[model samples]
Target: MEMPSLYGRVLPSPPAVDFNSAEGKRLFSEALQGGTMEGFFSLISYFQTQSEPAFCGLASLSVVLNALAIDPGSRWKGPWRWFDESMLDCCEPLDKVKAQGITFGKVACLAHCSGANVQSFRANRATIHDFRRHLIRCASSQDCHLIASYHREPFKQTGTGHFSPIGGYHAGQDMALILDVARFKYPPHWVPLSLLWEAMNTTDESTGLHRGFMLISRHTAAPSLLYTVSCGNESWKSIAKYCVEDLPNLLKAESPDDVPTLLSHLIESLPANAGALIKWVVEVRRKEEGRPTLSKEEKERLFLKENVLQQVRDTKLFYEVHGQQYAKSCCSCSSSSEEDSLTRIAAAVCCQGVAMLSGNLASRDGLCCRETCIRCIQANGDGLKTVISGTVVSEGNEQAVDMLLPISSPYTSSCNSTVSDEIVNYPSNTDVLTVLLLSLHPNTWLGIKDEKLKAEFQALVSTDNLPDVLKQEIVHLRRQLVYLCKAEEAGSHVPPSH
Candidate 1:
């Protein structure tokens, strides 16, 4: 059987290259001498396709040779079996070589270049590492470029022999660049491109995943970008893309201005009706500023003013209802004496006699005698004195007069005797005198004269006389005694009848 000449149609030759550059010649010589025949062909093939190859020629050579070494019996195996049988063909391409190359290019660009024998390349660690490093360099040089690796096998059943490859690379130095190249659209197991880049740049392993899978990027220098993908329960696909770009921005914004702008952007990105919640929050904050704020002294002043105003209004209303006439009279009286006007006003309003004295009264405004009106006029001090005198006089009977004065005459001739009698008898009828005597105690009678004392004793006895019935009994007994004395005198010689 003769195979068709698929050389130009399937696997075309590489474009012409200037072997002028020392680096280029050195690479070419190394590939030929190292028994890496596929690597040399890959270099030539890369130049033939496009002016600037999308993938590194060296990386492509390493990938293909490594894949072939894993599966030696494959038809696509190259001439690299001379160095080590361990490096013989292992990766068997499912389609033709040209188709495989096209697939590999697309997969690499999408960051999914692990479809065929990627796991088998583990035996060739040097080749795999070199390939990964070359991809990183290529992607790093171009801001738009990204690369990724993946495991092509379906999810393994429990206890099955299937496994994942390219899981060791973190965000910063290795697999992170692939994530960055793919723009973080690779497998869910890969860390975010931004985080992988950050991790690579920062060299921070702690920033990325410990197990499962991770992505990293070099977006910032301070804190490395890092994100994890877990296959345990939840899917990482939904949040993976967002986390790469949004998380870094969220963590970096520190000022109020930045926060509001960020928050607005976040709100806008949410589903409809979510913006209403944020609007409500902002309104509440604005309302808080309008409520009254009070100071200690100002509050106290307001309270005092209210009390004074209430008092003044009450006083005015009272005067308007009861003291209108007196108020008019007070004007005339005030000219003669302000005390007199206040006294008249108090008496008119309270219906009591009042006196105003200089020592006992003063005005609220320091103009008129307000205290005199309150004490003397409203209290009727003069009328109280008169009532007291009248009470004493009305209580005076014949026995009362005798008890009060102890004078030989029926009537007390001296007014001094009346006063003395009143002073002495005061305690027997009044609580005030009793309290006064208690207060004076042993010195109570010190200033009292003998005549005054006699009058006081008489008054006390008179005030505390026996009842009329007892007095009548005494009178009858005295009469009976008189009759007996007369009968005894008349019957001096005769024995009194038994």
Candidate 2:
């Protein structure tokens, strides 16, 4: 059968010079002579086509991320750890991204979430001269990359908005090399810097936000071992409102004894977009209320989604319980100043340079990563054991064993070794949450009186008969927990605060 066209070609009418054309090669040679093609080799090494029509941003990000040797901290397909469009779901859901594409801010948010240093400039917020300077800096440096979100119409291209990494610059021609992710439609091309800025200056109709450019670089510290919660979604405001305004009011109006019932009501009354916070609660409730037996096929179908929910719940519980432990533990070093204390913690945990701190060492007021280095430590008797189980591969009988692993076995551990690690050093917040959950004691979940929450806790901590990858993740977390114990033991002279 004859195949239909996938996308239209980039018309020669566009002002941009195709990178493979004679004129393009001439300009690129000139760019190299002017020392503006320093970053070109790095990007070209990992250049990839966007897998989906609307996944240009993801593709560009993946290229830059890999070029910079940034670890995605998660497997891409099987055993290899790398960045892929599918792994970039922290800022926006993949389904939403596939349908609506992504915005400049969201792209920057994803870069930041992936443990890269991001500096974003919307067209309205920055002048043309500023963009030119950034372009030169990015093109002249292999350490950084520039991604532009611009309107295709300005370049007379076939699409609306687009994202592509700026691979090189030509000072003499005043041109920028766009390593367009949508290679099917447009090849790598050199467009006049002024013209590219004009494209980026246009407005995106959906977000009512200006198109822009961003500079992404690797973070100075090592990637974080644990995941943290992010408040970047549309439901963040409602979640915050519920936590700050609604929760306080609910507590004050109800008696202490009635609070539990009120909370249960609150769970039921929560808005549908309570987002990631409530799905696990609802799942847990359904599991307990129904306790329905399922066929092997059903369990296999639900495994991926359920595992994600469990990981999220685990991270939330960890931050709630031990977010402040690192600060407290560092203070135990008896350093004379906050800087000195941070220095000690860095030496102990990072083992390289200073471990990056989130805020003032005295307070846990912000969302810094307080749980790092737990993986390097060995799991003492108190921490969860590293249990290697069945492979995550989907088949007949093994799927049943992986699904039936006991989730809520009772666990007891001494609180003596429960010291916290570094803050906010992780790449994706999801990873942060996953690692944090691993460090948790079974008793932490068992202490909660709410049956739904308890069920959610069980899901988070359960390691029995899981897929190999997930079990490996648990082992990593347990390793981190072991470090916590070691840190606590070193400072055992100062008793841990309850």
Give the number of the best model, judged by TM-score: 2
Report the lDDT tens digits of candidate 1 across residue range 89-151. 112221322232222222221111111111111111223344455434333332112222222
Model 2 CA deviation exceeding 4 Å by range = 1-10, 223-227, 230-498
- Top model by lDDT, which number? 2
Local distance difference test, candidate 1: 0.22
Off by over 4 Å in 1: 1-65, 68-106, 109-237, 252-498
Write the residue-wise lDDT of candidate 2 on 101-120 in tens digits: 98776677677667676667
Q: Weakest 10 consecutive residues, lDDT, candidate 2?
A: 278-287
Query: Can you give the lDDT of residue 484 in candidate 1?
Result: 21
Estimate candidate 2's alpha-carbon lDDT, on a 0 to 1 scale. 0.56
TM-score to native of every candidate shown: 0.15, 0.54
